[model samples]
Target: MTTIQPTHRRGATRLTDAGRDIATMLWRDTIRTARQPEMLVFAVVMGVFFLVLFNYVFGGAIGAGAEVDYLQFLVPGVFVITALQGAQQSSMGLATDLAEGVTDRFRSLPMSQVAVIAGRTLADAFRNLVGLALVALLALVMGYRFDSATGAVAAILLATAVGFGFSWLGAAIAAKVRQPDMVGMLSMFWLFPLMLASTAFAPADSMPGWLQPFATYQPISVASDAVRGLCDGALDTGDLVLAVGWTVGLLAVFAPLSIRIYTETD
Candidate 1:
């Protein structure tokens, strides 16, 4: 009878103090990452590896044919990828918690369940900021220059938002599967197609005509092009609008679904 009370409380839980509850979960995630610093190091190393690989290995060949500077175009796309990687990490982290019964422990408490997903996504965003900063610093060292400081800031924010949208997708996946490894495997199926098929690595024209339509209009392509334009001072208003729309739409649809799935999950 005593255990039933908290279970019943689940349906009605709302943040009495939204700030305190969300902040507590956010801090919990932060402390957990701090205690396992290797993950951060791995993230940084992976970002660096991609930057080096693309800019040096493909820059000369790709830039000769294209009018744009390869290094400049590449940086913003990498920023989006880095941000999304952080979101992927959030998925794995949430799945681990679910597998270990940590989410059940959280459910037994009185705090707002929405705070859990919100805090998790926000913490992942913060983690991504660190990764973005590192990659940007390296880009500068490697001769990647932005056209305007304000534009650069806007591009970074857009990249973060794209990452945030995907984080909700991650949260929803974690909630549904409740297994860390499976989330990673399943996410890769879509992640690779979206990231690779889009303008992240190369121009859409370089792809097959049949595939170009999909690559040119997908969220990753729109977001990458917008970010690239912002950095390169070639701003395309339409692409930016589409990118913003995609971010808002993803959050609008997935945020509630993630919260519902999470709350209902065992």
Candidate 2:
């Protein structure tokens, strides 16, 4: 019997392979989202609602000394919150696929293993853009505007990367847990505490004496502050480094873990 030859992607550089796989997965996600636009709509509505509610509810309380036009402060915080919610969708999708036996079908195919993770994540990145655009448009209609388009785009891209990174982490969790309900519940529970405990709503100095320290240094706070700087053209190397660290670091840890678990999982 002739020996079987291992499949080789001839001269397909890593970047090319990654780009090809990402495009394929992204198309799949876009089609899927188009078929079920409710998810996208819901995310947009939620982002808009929170932005309005928070801007009015706590705007005066925070005081102009704290932040002029609390909507500006609210915008950055809501951006991070929206990114977190976007990650939950990523987990939900993975959990749905696993529960419905779709992932098994992917496993039986000749597609690259990493493609599934990367594609799903790239798709979530697009979802993030749609959500962000909706929120930004709504904010504009409500009298909110960014000082610089280039900076806004940079911050949004960074936000999308963060969303994608967390989505991968969520995928890893969903794959290992194998339960959609628990996946959503656990993800939301953690996400909620993480957002509330930080400086999302108010400055860390405004927080209680007991909570100030943690809130000041929380990763989410750092991220929100960085995004604020980006929108305001106060970009600094430190913030960029922190933003990149959070996105790349999360992906570095979770992306490989997700692939490994998916490969070994039943």
Q: Give residue 119's lDDT in candidate 2 (0 to 100).
A: 79
| lDDT (tens digit, per residue) of candidate 2 on 1-266 | 89887666566665687678768877887898789888888888778778988888767777556537788777877887788788888898887776766778888876677887777777777988889878878877888778799988887777677778788889899878868888988897768766888766777787789887777666677777787778778876786687678778888899899889888954
Q: Model 2 lDDT vs. the true structure?
A: 0.79
The models' CA-based lDDT, in order, is: 0.85, 0.79
lDDT of 1 at 74: 87
TM-score versus the correct structure, for each prediction: 0.90, 0.90
Off by over 4 Å in 2: 1-19, 64-67
Candidate 1, residues 129-207, lDDT tens digits: the string is: 7778788899999999999999888888889889899999999999899888999998897688988888987889988
**Candidate 1: regions farther than 4 A off:** 1-16
